[model samples]
Target: MPTATADVLDELVRASALLTEANSVTRLIAAMVEQANDITRSDLAAFYLRTDHSEEVSFKLSYRRGRLDSPKELATNGELVEFLEESEESVVLLERKNSPFNELLLDSNSASGVALPLVTGRSLLGVLIVNSREERFYGRARLQFLDSLARIAAGVLNNAQLYRELQEHARQIEELQRYQENVFSSMTNLLVTTDESGRVHYFNRAAAERFALDEARVGLTLKDIFGKGLTKDVFKTIDTVEQNGQTVLGLEGIYKTDEIDIDYSLNIAPLQGKRGRHEGLTLIFTDQTAESRLKQEMKVVSEERRLIKDMFSSYLSEDIVKLLVENPDLVKPGGGARNATVFFADIAGYTNFSEGKDPASIVKILNEFFEEAEPIIRRHRGYLDKYIGDCIMAVFGVPVDAGEEDTVHAVTCALELQMLVNSPRRTFFRGEAEHLRIQIGMHTGPVVAGNLGGSRRMDFTEIGDTVNVAARLEGVAVAGEIIITENTRQHLGDRFSLEERKPVEVKGKKKPIKIFNVIGIDQQSA
Candidate 1:
């Protein structure tokens, strides 16, 4: 062989080795095109791979020697890529002359060129091209050398393409797996997977905190996380799912720790393989401890509200119920010593009126009398504490602000009760109750007022010497008369017409208690 021919053959061997040894198609094509350009002594060389086998000729991979720019413009040369794909032959242009291929590379210094399709096993993979500034540089011998190089590289290029596609598919699968794992771990609900033998395999962050377990608990069994009792429930739920592919839902269980008890709703489903065979079990746990506690608290609060409404709805105004509801601390079981007025009202001659009356008749008469008097106590902002038979006990300045007018309200309530009793239209037992008279007594002093009773039953009332003095004053008052003590008289502040009675000795007192009969509201004050 001549020296030039020998060098060309050696270049062919090197090109063959480079194409076969390259792990990536890009590296192989780039090296191959560069070598082909040098061996042919051309100004430019490029490789264009056909992207799709369609009427629209499109090229995807384009690499040009020493030019980082894409060959998109050259590839769009519909006439050129079509000539290579359809003809499956080489095109040789010996002079810078008029041709559709030459017009495509108007900016090239090329005067002559050769284009050969890189075909293997009847598949046209791409086209290789060489351009030279000198005319007729690629004669019969050089063209033959280029043809031999294309033949040597076709099969290797095809394999490298397949390998690259496989690599990209693997990378995509890996990215998809990472995305799925991130979504699973970020959830707040407890998630865990168990094997067929009930051994735990996976646990997320929320599962760790919920079960009070860590990564070390991964290999533990169901019995390990929850003791025998709860584990039995877990297994039973899982068995239900495994039997007929039925989902077990809303199975609530309690998991108690040293700090608090956790109530959780659970769901169990089968972990199935691609062929739909049951591989294991997937357990989903939703923490409902806070929600359950809130529901219980709401239930208690609702019950309390209903009870308060039922107890006071007959007499207390809606505004008072609303105030007590908003400020529950005011009625919660505790008492404070405060200056307040207590009122006691009783029916005169009750023992004689009840002698011949049946038990139901006596109760009916007492209810009628109290029904007429309770609203007057509420109107004066006095809480009607209790009804002792036909007697009414009311307290002012409790569970709310009664202001400085508490004493005035007490005496005013007494006067209103007497007026309601003396009204002619108000009849009981067919006018037999017409002769019934009311005795009213009120006193102001330090009294302890609060809810007093067991947890199940409670009464809001006052207890102190003040309550006793008021009750005693009611006993000494004659029919249709309202009497009050010295303490209450001071707080009246000229609001009522008072009759100073003789000093009277009373039980629970070291001295004679000064008393006054409240005739009526002063005309000026009224």
Candidate 2:
């Protein structure tokens, strides 16, 4: 109706049209601030808007006269402090608000000021200030004029702010895409992502190049990879993870593609979905060169345990040694967690016999003893957990499924070890033939299990009352003996004649465990 309202209406019309065509919020805000300044007839004008990064608030200029300065990039902290405090005030005219903008306007330019806050629910989105050089610069005509302009401009600026934020988000996403492309394309390791149902979602460029894979074959199921027989380890790891919900990583295995040795180390992890759901799996597969160095290191580490297992098998059982080797991750030291069984064995007179033999011969004979004892252990399907000196400790149903024959297997291995020592192999171990004997003590019970180590060195081993009692029984056992515990006897369930031995206290065990002499099963009796 009035000139100011008419001019304000014109700016509102122009702001709306510019907003409609504006692809970005920055452009829209430029339109809003520019039109607001024009209609208010201000000599100088600036607008500051706020954004949140968590609880902390920072300011970006929504619009300013300097086109070269990105209004969005300028930090407006400590600049318009009091101006914001007075947004609800009917007016703040030509008075400093203890703000830098107020002081700067007074110092650098003789400008009278009119400032207002853009208030939304007690939060200041921004402030707009118009400055003119002439005194009594704003009348009721001018304040009404600026207020009219602020009203229309505020709504337009609100829309522009939304548009700008959305545009900035789109930009961030594009940059992230570029980053992903750069990383994925150049990675030396194979990278793959699969959907919730095991369907292929992404395979990096390295994976494609390493496999010489064609696009026609990229998005198929794991079955397709197996159909091509690209890798058995890949399919096996995938199947294991899918079936068990285990996140497995670092699987190193050789790939035989017509005798071209391809070694791969695979890392498999579950992909989490929105809301912490397991969506699928992602894999990073490293090829042979790095794998070889790692294998060398691992081989060195496992070498001692492997040797210990090899020698222990001579006196104990193959099943147990295999168990130790196959599931090293299963046996952790000092865990006190019960698994399934505990086993112990010792070479009778091993300590005394070693005194007479040369060091090399002792090593050789011990090795031979183990070689002689290997088969009977495997026949029983058990795991040899560890060996102490000539003593061999083994257990069934550990690190893997232990069949029902655990007791029979232990008995059978004992008999075989004795029988083997009696053979010509016994001739090579004349010391064993002359005096030394072997004893096995087995008890089925729980033992702690997990990876055990210090801040640095560690070993996977079982330490519990079960393990302690088993070792005690083995220590008291007479050589060439097959002694089992009451628990093992029960597990054996009369399949073997376990002649009751007196309850004996083993070291570290609070109470004595019932020990027995294990002999003839039903098959043995027949």
Candidate 3:
């Protein structure tokens, strides 16, 4: 590439990174406005991005130096509004005689300004107004520069806005669907549609709501969710979806949660574009609920039905992930109460193993270990919250919620830790490496969970006393053993036999917590 071409490309890349990296609007709001101002060397720059038509509020800054926050009010005024609202769609810069901005200042001749409608394509996104104290400062070059910035800003702003809007829309859908999910979840089934690659582009409220799906089922690899337990069914489902020939509403019942025996009312709605080439499919599911959920609706679940859910990040870098998680509430803050089980699991010997192995081998083992253990984590309506060191920290209930037996679910999840270590897929070298094994620790309690952290860096993690206990417990656990507090033991009750262990002192604790070892069905609880 030519030198200038290379420089532009680099800037574009940087701009993309900047926009993509922005998890919150506030971080970039000032910087974006400032960049625009700095680009033109203008004293003041203000941005008002378009929001929904009804609101008349821009997705961005409503007002900068002065004037109403939005142009709708300015449009109500005489000249400035007319230039933007009435005048033909063309860049308009007015002098002291004809300009409202000019008329406002007594020194009228002291400065000149540029006002460009914040538009993407023909649709009016909003308006951008920049000012300079020097008169006649905005000429065609300046206007063109401002125009380019506005376009870039519009594109980035709209993209970020849409990205954010989609998140909000997803959250809204997740919320509204959650209510419907509970109502119909017992009766209504789930259906999903996707391409051959198994990228789930569409799923009904039932599919995601019931299954504890991470996102809108688009752009993610199905293996990311369905890789474990139902490998053949997963492949068969993808093939059946890709065939694009049949409308499948129901498949033989498959296990959804580790406990719930369920089936899918699979629907393959092919969405084709201009060409008849199969573009996508819609898959829906119907729950078989071994025992009808309808009868149980009146009876409150022992645990909060709300499941933990967060937008997945492994597929994308942390930056876009933050944007996806945060953009939804660009205009509004948080409003929702969710009850979920937070889970934290980590390999007990990962650090020791890491010390012995090469960087590549360590990473390889980590990936391999995650690949092996992740499915078990998901089996109990648990989400892979994050991987910390050799440990995996996850939550059972927040990105979505776990309706019944959350404690039961989380405990059972803890019990499965040994299976993760012993799985043949897990490769441990001979000798010292042979000692490496995984440990799981979990606790159950209510917590306020949501997309947390910040723009530069952020993560979807659950926070609460329960989450902390789980983390500390995971650290204290011995290899191949699932350690849980008595609180969790109570939830499991007679469902499974557990062995009691002497109380152990944990950090920042005033009392010792009685722990338990989950033994086999044949073992005694005592």
Going through the candidates in order, what is the number of backbone clashes in each?
Answer: 0, 15, 41
TM-score of each: 0.49, 0.43, 0.36
Candidate 2 ranges beyond 4 A from true positions: 1-8, 15-34, 48-80, 86-112, 120-122, 132-145, 158-163, 230-237, 250-261, 289-526
Model 2 per-residue lDDT tens digits across residues 1-526:
2356666467556656765676665675566566556665667667767677998777655577621222344344544455464545434456444545553342245446766666655666666666666656766656775665566556666766666778899999999999998999998888888888887778889877676566676567867653454566568778788767788878876655552445788788888877868777888888876667888989876885775465445534555566666665544444545545566667777787688667887877777777656555656675556657777777665445454566566676676776766565464467444566677776777767544669675555656667777777777778767777777777665566667878887777678778888765567654
lDDT of 2: 0.65
Tens-digit lDDT track of model 1 for 1-526: 2137777688778778877877788888887887787766677787877676566656554778733232444455568767876777888888888787773342366677788888877788888877777787778767877888887778788888888888999999999988877877798788989886678988877777767778888878876776633656667667778787787889888767575467788888888888887777888888897667778999988887776667566656578877877666666566777778988898888988889778987888888777767777888888888888878888887756576688888888888888877777775534566688889888898888776778898867789999999999989998899999889998888788999999899987889989999999899976
Per-candidate local distance difference test: 0.78, 0.65, 0.59
Best model per lDDT: 1
In terms of TM-score, how similar is model 2 to the real structure?
0.43
Which stretches of model 1 miss by more than 4 angstroms? 1-9, 20-26, 49-57, 66-72, 75-77, 96-109, 119-125, 151-164, 195-199, 219-229, 256-261, 293-526
lDDT of 1 at 483: 90
Worst lDDT window (10 residues) for model 1? 66-75
Superior candidate under TM-score, 1 versus 3: 1
